[model samples]
Target: MSKIETSILVEAKEPDTETLLVLNDIPLDEQVEGLIRNHKELNITRHRSEKLALSSGPDPTGLKILPASSRQRFEESGIDVSRGYPEVPDRSQIPVFVDQAFAIRNYDLPYTERGKNADKDKKSLFGAATEVINLTKNVGTEIVGLQLENLTDQQKDELALLIAERVVVFFRDQKLSPKTQRKLGEYWGHVEVHPQTPQVPDLPGVTVIWNDYKIKQGMNLNYSNNNLGNWDATKNPAIGNQVWHADLVHERQPAGYTHLHLDAIPGVGGDTIWASGYAAYDKLSDEFKQLLDGKEAVYISAHGYLDRDDPFSGPKKVERVHPIVRTHPATGWKYLFVNRAMTRRIVGFSPVESDLILNYLFDVYEKNADIQVRFKWSNTKTGYGTSAIWDNRIAQHRAVWDHEGKDARHGTRVTSLAEKPYFDPDSKSQRESLGKYLHKWE
Candidate 1:
C-alpha cells in the first residue's frame, strides 16, 4: 500500500474573524459550490494557497448556522469540521438521490488520517519479500513466495492485514501440516472449535473434510443391504452444498478468518468462489442503503448441525442478531453481512417484506459476477497443498459440488472467532477503504 501525503489545513484567519478551514488542492466547481450550499454553516471562498477556505461565524451573509442534529450526523459520518468537508461529487457522478438529507447522508466522506500507516515496514523472515497477485478488482489476492510453516510474527501480521483487506487470499504449494495450520490460524485470533462438526482424531481443533466418492458408494451399499431408501437420491449431502454463506454467523461472535487447505481434489472440478460483501453493499441504491443503515437480521444455525440436547455442545438451535450491514472492525469498511445459509429474516420487518428484501439482496452475491473470485484446485496431482485464508466477516463462499461421486475432494478447515458485527457510520466501503492497496498491486 502507498502512503498518503496530503493534509487538511484548518486555521483561524484572524482573532475575531470566523475559523477558516482550507481544503487544499481540491477542485471547487459549481457542483461543489452547490453541495457546500446544501450544508449551512459552510461558506466556500478562494484562498491565497490555491485552496478553498470555508468560513464559519455569525454574519447573515457570511455563513448559515447548522442545527445540532445535522452537526451530529456530519461528525458521525467522519466529516472533519476542523479539516474540511467531504468532496462533492459532480451531478453525473451521483448514484441515487431522494432528498438533500439523503444525499448528504449517503456521501462517501473522507477520514482525517486515512491510509496514514499503509507503508509501514513489512519485512519478514521470508527474505523480507512477498509477491501479491490481485485476483479481482476488490475480492481476492494470491500471495506467493512464503511458506506458511516458516512465517515470522511480522509476516503473520502482514498476512492478516492483507487477508482483511483482500477479503480472501490464496497460497499454492504450501502443503502446511495440521499443526502448522493451527499455528497460522492462531496468529490472527483465537481458533474456533466447531460446536458439532467432528474434529481430527488427534489434532484437536482441526476439522477434517473428507469427501471420497468410493467411501460414499460403500455407505450406499450398506444402506441398500439394510433395505433403506436410495442413499444417492434421497440422502446425498451434495444436495445442500450450493448455498452461499459465511462460516458460523449464528454465533454471537462469529468466526472471522477461516483457513481451508485442500490437500486432495478432483481432476476437473471442485472450484470455490467467494463474493465481496463490500461490493454488494456499495452497489445498492442510496434509498436501500439508508433503509438498512441501522437494521439488524436474524441468523440461525443449520438444523442437525448443532445438538441442543448435548450438554457439552450446549444448544441444538443457535441464533444471533447482527447488523444487516456490518463495518469490519479492523479496516473500517462496511460489508453486507447477511447470507443465504444462516440469515433467516430481517429484524423489525414483516415476513413478506423480509423475504422480498432478502431475496433481492441475496442476488447480489449470486448474480454479480463482477464482485466474485473463483479459484480452481488443480495442484492436487502434484501433492502440493493449496490453501485459502479468508475474512468470513466480509465474504461469502460456496463449494462447487460437480465432482460428486466421481472423485475425492478432501481438506481441513480452521476458523478464528472475532468480535460481534456492528455498523459504524464513519466507515467507508471496501473499495474506497483499500484503494491504495489495490492500486499498489495494480
Candidate 2:
C-alpha cells in the first residue's frame, strides 16, 4: 500500500540552544536588581549584551559564592543562599511568558480543541533536515533528529496535525519534564485531570504512569516491590492485563491527544502497540460499514469503584454512550470506535448479536498484522527514553506487559480532552480518499 514507506535518516549538522525550552525562573524586570542585590561581584550599571557568558570560576570545584556580607540580603524573598549557585544561564535563552494567558489550574473549565480544519503543516517547522521513519504505511511515525523541547507554538501545532494524520507520532531524546509536558497538554486542550490518579504536587492534570500506582513509596525507591510485569507470553493475554482501549472513553468529552513521556523502561519488553482506526475501517466491507455508521454504543470506564451510597453492593462502572462509527474532526474520516475492553454493547442489538459482531471487529483490529505497529520504548543517546503522542479520537492502543515488572517502568501522561465522539455522514474512508493500493489478499 502506497509503496511501502521507508525510514530516512539525516545527521544533525548544527544544534541551537536559543530554541531549547527554558523554565525562565528569572524575570527580565527583576534580573538586574536581583543580581545586584544577591551577588556583590557584578557591577549593576555594567552594559549587558543580548547573550552573556559568565566568567569561569577560578576554583577546582567550579562553584561560585556571594560574599559573606551579601548573606544578609539572602533572607529576602528574591534571594537565596541555602543552595549553591549552578552556572549562570544565558539571559537570551530564557522563555518569555505572556501575562495574557490563563495560568494552569486543576478545576474544571471550558476549553476548545484545535486542528478542526485538518490543515496539516507538512513543511518542517524548524527548517532542519530530520530522519522521518514511518513504522507502517498507515500508522506510526518516528521523528528523529529533533527534540520536543525545542519546538515553537507553531511547531507544536504542526506536530498535532502530524499525529492526527499518522495515528501516533513518536520522538526520542526528548528532554521534556512533567511540568513542561503538562504545559504542552494545556496548549492542546483542557487537560484531563484525574483526582484519584497520583499526580505531581503542583501539576494537577499530569498523571503519573508508574508501574505500581503507589506514590508514597518514595519514587519507587524500594525497587523490590514493582518488578512484576503483568503480561505473560506463555498464557493467553489476560483481558484485565492486555486490554486494548482508548483513554477517557467514559467522559462526556473523551481524550483527543494523550501523550505519554516514558522516562523509565525495562531492558527488554515494555513496548506498546497501536492499531490504526482508519485502516481498520478501510478493511471492513461496504455492508458492514453501513451497519455501524450512525450507530451508538456503550463505553465503560476502565477502573470501577464502589458507589458511596451503596457500600454493600459491588463496584459500579461509569458508562457513556458514544457513536459506533465515529469521524475524526481533523481527518474527516470514519473509524470503528468500539474496543473489546471499554466498549460494552451496540445500542439497538441483542447481547448475543452484539457479542458476535464485536468479537469479529476486535479480531479485525487484533489479528491484522498489516494495520498495526508496535513501538519499542527504546531511549535515545540521552537515556530518558521516548515520548509517544497519539490521537485517541481514532485509534486503539495496548501496553505489552511482557516486561513483567522485573524492571521498573515509569512515565507521566497528559490527556487532552477533545470534542464528543461524532459521525460525519459526508466523510469518506482513508483508502477511498487517497486511492491507496490494496494488499494482494484484500
Candidate 3:
C-alpha cells in the first residue's frame, strides 16, 4: 500500500502529567497527527456498535460509556466517576419516543385551534391561578403553589386530570390539618381505609402507614395487627405495590387516586419512584404488542400482606383477573396492566406457560425504569404536613426507605376514588405520544 500524504502536527498548549502519560506510547509531537489519521475511523466503528446495541433484541447486560472529555471534567470537579451511571434512557429523548408511541393511537380528528376568548368562555376559579406546573414532558408535574386544604370541586377534578396526565404530581409545604386533608380526599372520590391500617380517630381518610418504630410509640390495635405489627410500609410499601401493577388491581373496583401526606420526613435520602405503564406500553413493537392483546392476568394482593398465614382471617385478601392490556378511563389510552406486587399469572394458561409470559411482561416493565420519574423529598418540609397524589389506575409507585434511622419520618395516607379497576376494552386508544407537550430533559 502507498503511504498517504498528510500535514498535521500535535502541539501541546500545556502538557500535564496525565496528558503526557497518554502520549507515552508515541512521540508527543506526533500524537495529534496519529489521532487525526485514526480517530475518525475509531469513532465510526463505535457509532455503528452503539446503534446495533439498540436492536440486538433485549440483552439483559448493562454497559455504559462516558465521553473521555466528560469523564475528565468529572475528575477535575471532584465528582465520583466510579459511582457510574444507571441504565436509563437519556431523559432528553424520552418525550420524543413517548410522543411517537402516542401518535399511533391518535384519533382522526383534526387539531382544533382555541380562540382568544377560550379562557373567558369558562368560569374562572382562583381568578387565573396557575394550578399545575408541568414538571417534565413525560415524567412529572407539580400542582403549583396551591394549598389542598380547601380546593373547589372543580380544582379537585383538575388535579385528578393532572395526575392522570403526568402520572405523578407533587405538592410542597402543605400544612393541612388532618381533618382538612381527609376532607380534601373526599372530593376526589370514596376513600378506603387500608384493610390493615387504622384510621386516625378524628380523621377518617387519614390512616397512618406504620413502621416498626411507630408501633413502639403507643400505637394501639387500631393500627397494628399482632401479625403485621413489625412490618414497615416506608421500607417497602411495594410489599404490595412493587409488583408491576396499578393500586388495588385485585379489587372488583380499583381505586382512582391515593394520597400520602408526609408527616415526619428524614433529614436526607428518601424519595418516591414511579414509572408509567402508559409509557411502557407505548414503547412496545407491533409484534410484541400483538402477543399481549386481549390477554388477562390474575392479580392478587397477597404479596402486600406478606403474612398470608392468617388463614383464619377468612381470606381478608383481594384477588381478580384484569386485562393484560388496559385503557385509562379518562384519557382513553392503553397501558401495560401488570404490577410486580399484584399481578400473579395469566388465567387459563398452564403454570409453565403463565410463568413465561408473566415474567417477560415483568421484565419489560422493570427494564423501563429509565422512563420513570423519581421525586426526592425535601427534608426541610417533608415533615408531618406535605403530601402527594398519584393516580393508581394509570401509574405505579414505590417509596425509598434508604434513610432508616438517619432521619425518622412518618405519614398518613388516604386512597380516594370509587372507580373500581375495570378493563375498558372499548377505551383503549392507540398509544398516546407526549412529544409536543415536553420540556427539555436532563
Candidate 4:
C-alpha cells in the first residue's frame, strides 16, 4: 500500500574501487538521529524522504572503509553510534604464525642458562637497590629502587637468578616502550614471536598483553570474555574460572622469562595470582612424585589450529608433549610443570585415567592458596605501570578478571623462548634444598 524509504546514508570508499552507498533498511527514530548529528566525528549528510542520516569516514591506505558493524551492534541494542568504526588487521603485511610445529621452532638460537654462576651472598643490585620485598613466602618478590631498563649486565644476570629462585619478580616505575621492552627481553634470551598473537605493528616480537579491544568506540575499548581457557562449571556454560597456565607451553622450546609491563590499570581490583610449581610438587605425596617423575603430557596451544592428523575435525589445537615434572636449569630444582589449562592428557594413560590423575594434580595447584601469591597491579594512563617478570618455567599464573575489563589494563609483554623443557632426576625440590619440611596428609 505504501512505498517506504529508510535512514542512515553512510558514504564509504572501497580500496582501489569507487565509492559505495551504505544504508539501513528501516527509518531511524528522531531521538537516535539527534544523537548522531551531535557526534563530532559523525555528520548528518541526509537520510530519506522522511528521516535524516549519518555519513561514514573515508577509507585510508591498506584499510578500506566498511559498514560500521560496531555502530550497528550498539544501535540495535538501543545505543547511539558515538564511537568510531573498528579497524581489523589486514594481516597481509604482517601475519600471525599458526603452523607452530615443534620442528620448525625447535632449533637453538643462543640461550645461556641464567643464575649459572650466581652469588649466593647478594644483598643489593649494583649499589642502587634499596629493597627486595618478598611479596609472599614462596612466589613473588618486588625489587625496589632499580629500573629494569637501566640495569647492568651483571645486575640483569642476578635478577634472572632471583626470578629463577622466586618464580616471579616485580619492578615498578618502568618507562620502557614496546621496542625497549623487546630489547630487555633480548638480553634474557630469544624473544618469542607468538603463533597467533597480535603484535605491536612496528615491533613484531612484543605482544599487547591485555587484549580487551573487542569493540573500540572512539577511545573506548570494550571487553570480550577474558575468561577464555576455563572450560565449564555451572549449568549451560556458566562463568568458568580463569585458568592457571604457563605461557607458550605448546612451543617446541617453551617460554622462560615473561615480562608484562602494565601501562594502564583500573582504580582497583584486577590482580594476578601465580602458584609456585615447586610448592605444588612438594605438596604431592612421595608415591605420586614417583609416578609422574619421567612421564610426559600433551600441551595444546591456547590458539588452536586445524589438526593435521584429523583435518575433517574442525580446528585441532597444536600439541607439544613435555615432561609433567621439569627441573629449572638455573635453580636446579624440580617443580610441577603441568598446568590446569593446557596440559591435556598424560602419555600412555587412558582418557579416564589421565583425567583422574591430572585432575588431582590440577586440584593440588589450584586449591593451595598458601603456595600462591596474588599481586595487585598499580599502573595508570599517566605513566608506565608496574612490571612483573616471571620465570614461566616453574610458575603457573592466572589473571583475576574481577574487574571484568571495565578498566584499562593494557601492557606490553615479551616472552623469551628458553631451552626445551627438561627433567633432571638429580635435582632436588625447593623445599628439599631449603630444608623446609612439612607434615601433611594428601
Candidate 5:
C-alpha cells in the first residue's frame, strides 16, 4: 500500500530531561514516522516509515524530535494534538450563482400548486384508509379510522407491528364485546388465562378488572375479603397505585400481547400509565449496564398476588429466575425486565447489596417521566369504549386509583401467551430499534 501522510498540530511546552526520556520511550508502529518539535507550539508529522531516533545532547531542552505512531504518549505528556487538517470550502455565497441553478418554469403560480402532481403520486402502506396518532414520543400511540372487531388479516398483522413498535396502542369508541375481545386477541397469539384474576363466566380466557366503589367491590374477590391488606389502600393510596409491573411474570413464559377494553369507566379518575422498558435500559449508565449484563433475578408469583386458593392461580408459592435484561422476541431489542411487583432480588448478590442496586434500578423507571406515557380512559359522556393493546415484553403498566369513592372502573383484559424471557446478545437497544417510530410524528 502507498504511504498515507498525516500531520498533527500539537500545542505543547518545553519538556525537562525526565519528560523527554519518557516521551522518547514511546513505541511507534513500523509503518509510521514521527517529526516532533520543541517550540512553544509543536507540529508533528507522521508518515509511513521506520521510527525516528531521539535527540542526543547535553541540553535536549530545545530538541525537535518526531514522535512515532503512538498518540497516547503525547496525550500522557499533556500535549494537545490535532487529528487532521481542516477542509477548504468549495461553494460560494453569491446569490447570482444560485439563481443560475435549476428553477421551476411555473414558479409564478401558487405555492400549494407547485407540488400538486407529487402529492397525487405519493403512496403508503395504509394509504388514506387508516389514521395513526402518536400519544407520546416514547410509549403510546392512538390509532384511529379502524375498528378492532372488524379487522382483516392484513390489518391484524399491521396492528401487531404497531403494538410491538409503539409499546402500547389505543383505540377510542371501540364497541367490542367480551367474546369479540377474546377473538381480537387470537390474531396475535394464544389468549392467556390469567392465574390469579377472575375470568368472565361465559368467556374462558378473558379476565375482568372490576373496581366498584359503590358496592365496596374490588378487582380481586380475595383481595376484597382481605381488605387489600397487601397494598394498604387506606394508609397510603399513592403507594398502592404505584405498583408498576407486567402480568404473570412468575410464569415460565410470561405474557406477550395484552389487550384491555374498558367499557365502563368513571367520570373523573381511572387512568393508566405505561413506561418503556427499552428507554429504561437505554437510560442506564454504562457501568450499571455492564453490572446487569448476563445477570438473573428471582420472581415470585405469590409475592404479588393476594389470592392464594384461587385454583387458577397456578402454584401458590412458585418461583422463577429470569434474566434481568431481557430481549423482546418480536422486536429483538433489549429491555429492563425487573419490575416493582414481581421481582424479589438479584440471583447472586447479597441481601444488602441486592437491595441497594435494585432500589437504584427501580428509581430509573419510577422517576423518569420522559420515558412514560399516561392514558386516561374515556368517561360515560364519550360512550365509554376505549381499548388498548400493548407488548408486555417491552413495557410495564400501572393503574392510578384516584376514583376511590367517586365511581366504578371496570374492564375486560385478555393476555396472549409468549415464549420464556431470554436475553439476546445480538439484539439492539430500545432507542436504537425504535428510532424511526419515535420520530414518526415529527
Candidate 6:
C-alpha cells in the first residue's frame, strides 16, 4: 500500500490498530457511518476528516465563511477548508435609514469648542451654505449650495456621512476642476475603479467609467440606445446614469453616497427620480413579506466581463448574495434591498424561478413611482446651479435622457466613502412615515 497521509504526531504513542483500517480505499461517508454505528466517538471526528465526505466542497455553516485566519482553524477542526468561502454579511447588523442619516450629518460637528483651539478656528471647515438641511420629520434632507471641488478634511468626513445617509446628494451650480472633484472624493473613502476607463496618470480616486472607444482614445460616439442585460454599471458606462443603484452593493464595502454637481441642463428633459426602499417595504402586504422574509439575492456583473475594454474577461465577474429583506444597522428599519442595477438572482431557487422573482421585484421598483420623487432640471440663460441628496439605503434613482442640442448642460461628480451597506428590520416607524410622500405613477 502507498504511504498513508497523516498529520505529524507531537508525542509518539501507540496508534490505534483499528484506526489504520483502509479508510481512503473505501468511501468516506461509509467510513463515517461505520464509525458511528460502532459507537466510536473518537474515530467519528478524525484530525482531517472531511465535513461532508460525499459532498463536493466546504460546508456552509455561516461562520466558516469568515476572514482567512478563522477558516484555517475550521480546517484544523477536521472540517474541509479547501474551497474559498463566500462572504455572508451579518443581516442582524444592518442600519436603519434615519439613524444612518443622523450619523452622517453629525460626523464632524464639534460637541464643545470653547478653548484656544476654538478661538483659532474662524469657522467650521464646511461653509454655512454647505451644511445639510433637514427638511422633514421623515428623514429626507438636502445639502445645499456647496462646491465639493475644494472641501476641507472635516467637510469630507461630514460629507461621507451625508452620502451614507442620503444615497445621493446634490449641488447647485458647481464650478470646480475635475482634479479637485477627484480630490474631494478621496476624503470620503475608496473610489470605485472602473475596469474599462484609461487611468488618469497620477490620479488615485479618479477611476474612469469609460466605454471601449474612450479607453482607445476613439471618438465620443453616443450609444445610449443600447439594451441592458446584466445591469452591471460597467456593461454600459454612460447608461449607468440612467439606472437606480447603490454603488457596488456586491462589494464588501459599497458607496455611501454619490454627489453630483449639475452644471449642464437639457432644454426639455434632464430629470432624475429617487424612490425610497423603506417606504416601499412599509407599503407591502403581509403576504408579500412572508414570501420575501428569508429570501436572498445574487448580484452579478458578468456583462461587464464581456466588454472588450473591461479589465477582466470571460468568467471574471463580481457577485454578491445578500438578504432580500434587510434591517438597517443604525435605524433598525426593515427595507426591500434589491435594485435593478445589481441584484441578479434569488438563492435556493432554480434559474427560472430566480428570474421570475427578480423581474417582479425590478418591476416593483420601476412601477411604484409613489415611493419615489422626481427632480427635474431647467436651463436658465443666466448660469446657475441645483442639486438634491437622497438616501441610497432606502432610495432608488434614475436620470432622464431627453435633451436638445445647443442647450448646454454639464456637471461634475464627486463620490464619497464606500462603506459596507447594512440593513435593520426592526425600525418600522420611520419606514411607515415615508408613505405620505409616495409619487403617483403616470
- Highest lDDT, which number? 4
Q: Cα RMSD to native, each candidate?
A: 26.5, 19.7, 25.3, 12.9, 30.5, 18.3
lDDT over C-alpha atoms for residue 161 of model 6: 46
**Per-residue accuracy of model 2 over 1-442 as CA lDDT, tens digit each:** 1111111112345773122222235443343333332332342221121111232212211113222322222232133324332222232222111110111131345655565543365565435437788899889999887777667776777788888888999988776666678788988887887624444434567665654322222223223322122222112222323456778787777888989988766779878999988888889888778888999998866544334344235434567788988887777778888677677788999999987898788778877878889999877554455799999887888887676566666676899988767889899988877777644443
| Cα displacement (Å) at residue 121, model 6 | 23
Clash counts for all predictions: 3, 5, 22, 1, 4, 33
- Give the TM-scores of the predictions, in the order they appear: 0.63, 0.68, 0.60, 0.74, 0.62, 0.54
Best of the two (4, 6) by lDDT: 4
lDDT of prediction 1:
0.60
Candidate 1 per-residue lDDT, tens place, 298-395, comes to 88654321121232342233457889999876677888987876677899999999988987888887789998999986652264678899989888
Off by over 4 Å in 1: 1-130, 213-240, 305-316, 432-442
Model 2 TM-score, all chains together: 0.68
Which of 3 and 4 is ahead in lDDT?
A: 4
lDDT score, candidate 3? 0.51
What is the C-alpha lDDT profile of model 3 across 283-354, one tens digit per residue? 676566767777888776432211123322321233566788876655667788776656778878899898
Residue 152 lDDT in candidate 6 = 60
Task: Give model 1's TM-score versus the native structure.
Answer: 0.63
Better of 1 and 2 by TM-score: 2
C-alpha lDDT values of all predictions: 0.60, 0.63, 0.51, 0.66, 0.57, 0.46
In lDDT terms, how accurate is model 4?
0.66
Kindly give the stretch of ten consecutive residues in candidate 5 with the minimal lDDT sum: 42-51
lDDT of 6 by residue, 1-442 (tens): 2222222112335675334243465444334333332332322121111111111122243223233332332343343434422211121121112222122222332221111122122244335464655433323455555665556656555554444344445555544444655655554444444322222233434432222212122223233442242254345442434566555555544444455544445557667777666656656676777688767777654122122233123223356666788765434457778777677778998988877777677667767755566665552323554544444556666665454222333443444443344444444534453444433334
Which parts of model 3 are misplaced by more than 4 Å? 1-132, 212-246, 303-317, 379-384, 424-442
lDDT of 1 at 391: 87
lDDT string, candidate 4, 1-442, tens digits: 1212234334447764443233445333332332333332322212111121212231131122222322232244353223332222222221112243344476666788766676654544636687779998888998877777788777778888999988999987666666667888998889987533444444557765543442232212213544533442111111222567788898888899999877666678778899889999999888888899999999976543333344335434568899999998888899998876678899999999998898888878888998899998874334556889999988888888778666755666899989888899989988989988855666
